[model samples]
Each structure stands twice: as C-alpha cells, then as structure tokens.
Target: MTDSIRHLSIHIDRTRDDVYAFASNPENLPAWALGLGGSIVREGDEWVASDAPMGRVTVAFVPPNDLGVLDHDVTLPDGEVFNNPLRVITDGTGSLVVFTLRRPAGATDAEFERDAEMVTADLARLKELLESA
Candidate 1:
C-alpha cells in the first residue's frame, strides 16, 4: 500500500497571485525551503535543482492555483538515495504543501515521519515570509 499523508487548510495573509509567483519560481526555493542547499532553475517545462542533496531535481507538475509537484532523488550524507515528492495546493486562504518521501521499500517509517514534520515547519515559515511581505 502507498501511504499518503495530507496537510490541508493552512491560511496565509496574501493574494493568490503573490503566493503563486513566490512558489512557482525556482529562484525563491532556497529562501523559504529550510534545509535546501542551492539554486533551482527551469529546464524546458521542469524545475531543476543543482548543488542540492538531490544533485538534480525534476519538476513533475505546475498548475495555476490547483496544484504543483516536484520530485528529486536526494543523496544523503550517509550515501543513501531518497526519492522525494513535494506537492502543493491552494486552500482558498493559503496553501497546503505535502511532501512524500519514498525510501527503500524496507526503510523504517519513523524517519519518513520526521522528514514530513520538518517540511511542515518549513511550509509554516514560508507562510510567515509571504504574509509578512
């Protein structure tokens, strides 16, 4: 079974266009993405990240207000490669961002949960930055 976790109904004080612009641009990723290592860019229709743990990431989807998804194969400090999927959705008021990490099939669940928590906090930080600006 593919387990999925959802974080819905976050509210931020910003316009839809402002939020969309911030999230859609690859340049702004490091600004709000807490542990992100380096810069991001667009290669054709996909967003790509270089110098990050992932080495290079590909954007899976980008939509107006309904959805956006990014994926990467990240190399850990211990030399483990993790497949990371990030999803975002506008929730009328703010946005709901979900990050799903797929490790080796036999990997423990605890670490994945921890990673999800970290991403959730990062999203909260993003909300603060956008709303405050």
Candidate 2:
C-alpha cells in the first residue's frame, strides 16, 4: 500500500500571478526545487532534469492556465512515474503555495519524514527567492 498524503505549504509575500509565473516555468525548477538538482533543460516537449537525485528524470507539467495549478509528472529513469500536485493560490495581497506530497509505496517512516523535510526546504527556498526579488 502507498503511504498517506501530506500537504505542505509556504506563504510567499508576492502576488499569485508572480508566484505562479515563476513556479510554473519548468526552467525555473532548479532555482527552487532542489530535488531536481541545479539545472534542467528541455528535451523535445518535456523538461529533463539530468542531475536529479534519483538520476535523470523527465518532468511534464500541465498547460499554463489561470487556475494556479502547477501539477506535473516526474518519470524516473527506471520508468516509475510520480504525480505531483502543486498550486499557488491567493492569500490576501500575497500568495500561498501548496504542495501535496504522497509517500511512495513501501517507504519507511524515516524515509517519509525525510521526504517531507526536503519538500519543506524546497518551499522555503521558493519563498525566499520570490520574496526577496
């Protein structure tokens, strides 16, 4: 069975449009999503993260829309795919970014916690980058 879902969020002191514009761009993943390492490039229509922690991976995001959905699918080199649900919603004059992290099947408690920590750190990085800009 798969592990339970966990929702993590970070408040960015910026407009939703600004946040969404930055986060939705695949090229910007490396700047904030550290899990993708420090660089990502487009190969055909898909974004490729060649230095990802789990080796090279392909990320396919949803088409740009006004709904603030930033969902994407990451396919590992081993052919495993993970669907990631993410969004940037209005929060007063700023924005709130939420990421839904689901632990992979058969992951240990410690591993799940570690994944959460990594996501928290990534969101923190996003907040820092956007807020300071």
Candidate 3:
C-alpha cells in the first residue's frame, strides 16, 4: 500500500488561539473546505459530521496551540473508501496542515494529484480567513 501525504503551510497575521478556534470548529469547515456540507456534532471527545465526501469522521486528537488530528473513512465519487488522516500544527506563528491518505496498494497517481490541489486551495482559504479576521 502506498501512503501518500500532502503538506500545506500558510502564514497569517493572527494569534494562535484565534486561528485554532476558527479552524477547529467544524461549523467553519465549509468556509474553507470545498464540496462539504452538514454540521459537525461533538460526541464526547470526537467530532462527527455528515454530507461529506467521507460519510463520517471522528476527531482523533486536539492539542492546545500545537496540533489536531482527524481520522475518517473517506468515500470518493467512485465509491472508494480511503482511510484519511489529517494533521494540523502551528509553526509558532501560523500553521501547517497535512493530509496523509493510505491508499489500497496500487492506487492511481491521479488520486494524490487531486488531493494535493484540493488541500492547497483549502490552505489558501484558511490563510485568507486568518489574515482578514
């Protein structure tokens, strides 16, 4: 199985707490994420959401001003379930978010390319939000 990982980092002129609060809240996801819908509900330590490419996602980890992790079974348009791990970290000034997808051993290269573009655009939106907020 080839593990594909994509990294995106952007600097914003905002406090760490502000950035974290905005990004961590599921309600703000659609503001940055494309083609995502539904609200995020917190069940104990995990956050759940629907109408996403991923049927449901669980919050994996959330650390103060440092990191947050999310794990979920993501279904593509072709009905493929991809195990995705999303990690968010602060650069002590801004933040860097990465998405690592574990594809079925021989996944197509297009998969990585598509996700990279999507994630890059998401990061750009995040940067705009943080800078303008």
Clashes of each: 0, 0, 0
lDDT of 1 by residue, 3-118 (tens): 64434234556655566667666678777765555676777766556556645544333344444554445444455655666555566765665556444555467865776666
Estimate, for each residue in 32-79, the C-alpha lDDT of model 3 and write its tens digit.
865455565667765555566665544333344354554445445455
lDDT for each of the candidates?
0.60, 0.94, 0.61
Model 2 Cα lDDT, one tens digit per residue, 58-82: 9999999999999999999999999
Q: What local lDDT does model 3 show for residue 108? A: 81
TM-score of each: 0.61, 0.96, 0.62
Highest-scoring model, lDDT: 2
Better of 2 and 3 by lDDT: 2
lDDT score for residue 19 of model 2: 100
